[model samples]
Target: MGNDNDIRHGRHCVFLMHVHLVFVTKYRREVFTKEIIDDLRDIFASVCSDFEAELVEFDGEDDHVHLLVNYPPKVAVSTLVNSLKGVSSRMIRKKSYPSIRRKLWGGALWSPSYFAGSCGGAPIELIRQYIEQQQTPH
Candidate 1:
């Protein structure tokens, strides 16, 4: 059964916003290893925490990664993506991970563009029908 409390409660607003994000490596280079993926998971979790968001799930191959995040309404998706990429790139570089650096030429872990899609509880058509059922003026 689905959890009734899936919707998050903030001080002044309640929301259940989620975004599916996909980030590819620069030039589609295969740079990930088991250790690097582990580090990336931790880094992503930390970054999500900093933005009051939850990293619901994360997984990746050598060239790209996917993240499903539940974020508050106040946080912009772009800002979160930028921070995630920026912070992770910086942190990874600070370490001695030659595998990543050797493959990536520029000083970037992720490509310039990414994919973000919204996830919500109800379908738009269902919501539209529900809206149509609302009582109107006599």
Candidate 2:
């Protein structure tokens, strides 16, 4: 009842991909201040939204950040990493923390590389529930 191309395609499958990403500061300088961390949270959320992804969980100390994200199939992992790194670096240099500029020596806020791992079959919903339960009231 359908054409050859249509028949070959079968049903459309939605891919639910969860990735845990870790990004470190250049030379591990520990440059993230509380103010910078707050700003980074906002920026990361906005960027993830643009890419049709959800920033499920995010936290960082001064040197590194951990992000759990749910990404759509159309997006490339490298593209998301590059965008986040590049934009956050520029923003950190320009506004949030000028001290980082001195430390980076005109290079970058984040290291050249990142770590990404799949959360496949890892019960992400349960993890989310645990994180939510741990949240403290302000």
Candidate 3:
């Protein structure tokens, strides 16, 4: 079930938002081992904190990762994605993981394209119907 109390309070607003994010490796390389994935999960969590967001869930295959995040309205999604990719790339590469560095040529960890979608909320149709029923001034 979706969270009934997902609402969050900020200094000037209240909101509840969740996003599903996916990042694929460069050239779809199968580079991540179990240890690397674990490191990535930790890195993502730390990065989320910097943006006042929460990483609710994370999982992935060898070539990509899926992250569930709860973020505030004030945060730009693009900035978050960029930070996650850039920081994690640097950190992972710094570790000098031979397998990852070898497969990931061009010094890029993730492909430029990524997937992001809103999740765990009311259906769009329901919101549309509710809006249609509302009274408006002439």
Candidate 4:
């Protein structure tokens, strides 16, 4: 059985999927302010919604932002990340944010590489133990 609370009911299937993402500023520059982080939160949420996903949590320091996203199986994580990065970069810079664009070396706001990890599932050990305990009928 699966965790009822976490599973999302789709038209044909019940599933749960989550991924934690981290995006760092290009060259690791410490340039974000409170206002910038807030903007990023809204931007990411919007992007997630476009893909039928939810941004469960969002926060950041000066140079990096962390996101916890729950998404449907149809959405590819790479595509989602690409949109999140591309749209946010364009929107935030094109706005009246003068200091941010100047701080970046190039037109890009985020680094090319990012960190993504699967989360919100039972540990592997527990699954192994359950399998081991299963009875084999004679």
Candidate 5:
């Protein structure tokens, strides 16, 4: 005979979590073009990788951006968002897009705030699926 609790605890637990993140330009400015978006994507990926997360799907218009990311259990949402925004904004202004600095009158390419949500339960997967499906021609 064996203890049930001990047996249950013997298994390794892995949380397959996905999070959807949205970051917008300050005051919803139309600053991101195709070239800018591509540069930001690469910058985001490199930064996220340092935090033990992976950037899954990313797309955006001129004003805002949407990113689907998978992260390990140890990562905090705020830290992740802050790092992405801080680093990307700095890089974009300093190196990639200097015009943003001139237009914004400051060195801020992105807004100070961001939105992040976990996609574990409810209609999260359904929402991501819907976004994916929209790529098809109507």
Candidate 6:
């Protein structure tokens, strides 16, 4: 249920900002396993915490991921995206995910491109439905 009550209050502002983010693997390689996705979810949650944001929902396929983030007005989407992509890549690479390591030998986990859409004005249920519709590869 979407409501104005969900809006957050900062020092001088009250706002409700949500973004749907999608990131694909470098060259669109199928590198995610259940373990990898689990690790990534944790990583992304931590990153969002650092920025005082909430990672509302997260899901992924073998080669890409979708994130529903609720953030404050002060945070720039690009900066958040950069940190999410950068920190997660570094942390994932440090771990021993053999398949991912082999495919991402060049040291880049995500492609330079990403998809970001604001969901603030849309009804929360609609946003949730859209995210649920994301295709999960077998």
Q: Candidate 1 — which pairs collide?
A: none
Better of 3 and 6 by lDDT: 6
Q: Model 3: how far is 36 from its true place, Å? A: 0.6
Q: For model 6, what is the error of residue 83's alpha carbon versus the real structure, in angstroms, after optimal superposition?
A: 0.1
Worst 10 contiguous positions by lDDT, candidate 5:
1-10
**TM-score of candidate 6 relative to the true fold:** 0.85
| TM-score of every model versus the real structure | 0.92, 0.75, 0.94, 0.90, 0.75, 0.85
lDDT pick, better of 2 and 5:
2
- Candidate 2 segments whose C-alpha is farther than 4 A from its true place: 1-11, 122-138
Local distance difference test, candidate 4: 0.91
Best-first order by lDDT: 6, 3, 4, 1, 2, 5
Tens-digit lDDT string for candidate 6 (1-138): 368678889999988889999999999999999999999999999999999999999999999999999999899999999999999999999996998877877789999999999976777788799999999999
| Per-residue lDDT of candidate 3, residues 56-83 (tens digit) | 9999999999999999999999999999
Instruction: Tell me how many residue pairs clash in candidate 3.
Output: 0
Report the lDDT tens digits of candidate 2 across residue range 61-108. 989999998788778999999998888888777783666866777657
Clashes of 2: 0
Sort order, TM-score high to low: 3, 1, 4, 6, 2, 5
Q: State the lDDT of candidate 5 residue by residue for 48-132, as single tens digits.
A: 8998788989999988999998777688988999999999888888774644654675667778888888774447677788788
TM-score of structure candidate 1: 0.92
Quality of model 2 by C-alpha lDDT: 0.81
Q: Could you say which candidate leads in lDDT?
A: 6
- Which of the numbered candidates is closest to the native, going by highest TM-score? 3
Lowest-sum lDDT 10-residue window in model 2: 1-10
The whole-model C-alpha lDDT of candidate 5 against the native structure comes to 0.79
Worst 10 residues of 1 by lDDT: 1-10
Summing lDDT over every window of 10 consecutive residues in candidate 3, give the lowest-scoring window: 1-10
How many residue-pair clashes does candidate 6 contain? 0
Query: Model 1 Cα displacement at 44 (Å)?
Result: 0.6
Go through the candidates in order and give each one's C-alpha lDDT: 0.90, 0.81, 0.93, 0.91, 0.79, 0.94
